[model samples]
Target chain A: MKKYIWDGIFKNNPVLVLMIGLCPTVAVSTTVQNALGMGVAVLFVLTMSNLTISLLRPMVPESIRIPIFIIVISTFVTITDYVMHAYAPAIHKNLGIFVPLIVVNCIILGRAEAFASKHTPLPAILDGIGSGIGFTLAILGMAIIRELLGSGKLAGHIVLGTKFAATPILFFSLPPGAFLAIAVLIALTRLRK
Target chain B: MIRMIRSLVLVCVVAAGLLSWVYLFTKDRIEEDTRQKVRANLVELLGDTTLTFKPVIPDTLWEFYRDTTKLGIIFRSYGKGYGGPIPVLVALSMDTTILAIRPATPAEGLKETPGLGTKVTEPDFTNQFKNKKPSQIKLKKDGGEIDAITGATISSRGVVEAVQVGIAKYLKYLR
Candidate 1:
């Protein structure tokens, strides 16, 4: 249980470790709000897909299983795309194709292939929720740092007073900023280990 | 033999059942979502409270919005941006006077540079394009009109140029 739940949080965090789904990670993380929106979206899709895969595990033929998992994930993504478009156009616009791209997030597919097929429904769902939360926390952490340094304003609101927000460090908002931030955080994490 | 056929039929039925379940759940929403997106994009680029917009026009081309009497302006603005193309829709008052400019997609290549290129979507930048004539739309470099962004010359210039070309095309057709 611990391995299943804790692995995603840090030991095998998707963004921090495996580093799949970097596109959405960077794009939707412009603000803390967008990051939360995307994090929730990922959490929902990952959990639902995991649960469904586990429930259907017994009968799925091994050879054709990848296709089955994909279909299940895509269906959830479409639902999210539609729902977000209708209710949350801002987040919808922000997320863009990266939302559809979730159908291929290595974490979701990895869980399906690695755990869901062999696990029971409850454990699979728990594992999904746990890992999804881990992913959410990881992305949120990245967003906080990026928003702080890049925009000098977290979530579009003026943080650190208006003065600093107006003249944020130039490089933090660039591509190199993202790479540098990710590198430092990972390196810091390793030192802690 | 009868039992084997029944089992095979059962598996096929299950597979079909799952497929239909997902399809039924996702179909209408996807279409509705697209409709909403196009509408929002039109609004963002066009900014007319009265006109209704449609996405039937070619990509980065016209956004169709019609008032009660007849069809309204065709949006025609886009720029070669830092990462990619920044497309916009310009509305007119039928006499070729400006009506609105709704910015659509920001350049696609700016994912890594959101702090910079993403600013292209800002109202401050988009607002400058509104109410200006094609002749008055060039960047400060050409000595015609708009101000280039302080740090992001490429993005600033792209928006100005897109409006310049788009207005020229739209005005010709409107006349």
Candidate 2:
């Protein structure tokens, strides 16, 4: 049980160490606030999906279990999408297709198939929370570097200079910035050991 | 056998129940939120507060056509952008002048660096369209007005083109 959590959080993070779900991880990492907003959304979906899948494992037949898991995860995603669209439309708009793409996120579904189906419900939930944190940490780290150097702002405020937006090295906020940031973050985390 | 069937039915019911709970809780907030964002966008465009949302149109796709008297307008226009469609709002004065324009999805999901294409959201870029017409619109190189954000010609052009479509529609709707 602890092994699944340690593996998710540090030993094998889905984002930083494993480098999964790279799209939203880098896209929303522009601001700490955005990163956190997206992170919590993923966290909520992952935790609930994991819990529901685990609780239903006993009744799920092997032949149709994958289909059942998808329907369950997507239902939670649609629920999350609707809530975000209503309550946090800005982030909702910003996250865009990636939110729907959560249905295809292997991290959530993979755990459901591998660990949650076999494990006790409590362990599955903890594993979900730990991995959710791991993903959040990776995205937040990318956001810090990106926001600081990309636009020279912390949240939306100018911490570097008012002209930071006008300076060169404008690559920080672009899409490619996400790829490079993730690679560097991955390498740094790799070197941390 | 009976126990297994009962358990599956129980889980399905719980899932349905949870989904309904989520929907009920979200229904009001979602409506209020959209109203709030549109309200903010309208306020930014019209610069009028007391002019309350006159539900001039029954749909979310807000459009207004005025007679001798002025009416409010809210409509969306899409532009060719780097990644995909960029949604732009055209707010108008009944007299045919543009009151304000807001760019949605600045870079159209392109992962371009911030402070570059992202600057399209900045006041300087979007705010330039204020009170301007389609004729006055063009990149500085083309000799009309508004300078393109450096290293972001595609994004700048997207905003320019989106504004043009909105104006054309606004004109047609008035006529």
Candidate 3:
């Protein structure tokens, strides 16, 4: 049980190890706030979809399992979209199409097929949570580095202070910066292993 | 095959039911949020929360009034930008001098490139339009007073043209 949770964080870390769901990781990690928002949204969708898929696994016919999983996942994504837009309009606006695009995130669908469809509800949820945490940590790390170097701000606050006053390296805030940060992070993880 | 079809139908029906419930629950709040944001933007642009807005053209143009006195007018305009149409909200006082201008937010479908073109929405860019006449509303390169963003000439130009064209179309309504 513990292994199910820990494996996702350390062994099969989604962004660092599994490399699924990279689109949002790169797109929204420009800001730590955005990264956290995306992380939480993914967590909720993943956990709920995992639970629903596990519960329905026995009854879901083998021939049509993929489509049923999609139906379930998309339902949860839509719910998350509505709830976020209603309550967290600022972050919802910042996230833009990425919120709706969550329906197609491979992590949720991957788990549904590999873990949730076979596991009991409890373990399926734990795996969902573990994967979610792993994803969040990876993206959050990227956001901190990107936001700090790219804009000299941390969660929108100027942490580097006015004294440090060289113009921020704008490269860290663009798409190439996202790619470079991810590559360096992956390399560091590999070195540690 | 029969079982597969049955299960798929059942899952879809259940999903649809759940989605409809959520949609119904959130619909009103979403609309209210939008209205509140528009009001806030109007207040910010006009710099006066006390002013009441009367629609001159029902979502296209508005007239701001403080009691019996007419304050100014605000209208929507669009600029052809790199990403797509950039909607701009422009406010002009009774004399036809610009009061303030704002670009559509990302939520309102402004799709300029983040950190580059999106800077056009920032105050540094939008504030340039304030207190300027329509004739002065062009990028410095085009022999006008406003300056374009360092790397976002297209977006900056879009807002300038949007305000220019908007003023041309809506200024007559002020009189």
**How would you encode candidate 3's per-residue C-alpha lDDT over B38-122 as one tens digit per residue?**
7788898878888998877866798999997898899999998889999999999999999899899776789999889999889
Estimated TM-score for each candidate:
0.69, 0.73, 0.82
lDDT of each: 0.71, 0.77, 0.91
Candidate 2 CAPRI category? acceptable
Per-residue C-alpha lDDT of model 2 across residues B9-108, encoded as one tens digit per residue: 6666777888889989899988888678677776676666756554544432355433434475666776776656667777766666666777764434
Model 2 regions lying over 4 Å from their true place: A157-168, B1-14, B59-175
| Clash list (residue pairs), candidate 3 | none
Q: Which candidate has the highest lDDT of all?
A: 3
Docking verdict class for candidate 3: medium
lDDT value, residue A57 of candidate 3 = 85
Better of 1 and 2 by lDDT: 2
TM-score result, candidate 3: 0.82
Give the range of the ten consecutive residues with the poorest summed lDDT in model 3 chain B. B53-62
Best-performing candidate as measured by TM-score:
3
How well does candidate 2 reproduce the true complex, by DockQ? 0.41
Interface RMSD of each candidate, angstroms, one decimal:
5.4, 2.4, 0.7
Name the regions of candidate 3 deviating beyond 4 angstroms.
A157-161, A165-167, B55-59, B81-83, B93-98, B105-175
Over the stretch A1-193, how does candidate 1's per-residue lDDT look in tens digits?
A: 6677787777877777777666667666666888888899898988888998898777666666787788778777776776776678778777778788888888889888887888898889878887788778867877788889877887787777778788877576666776777777677767877
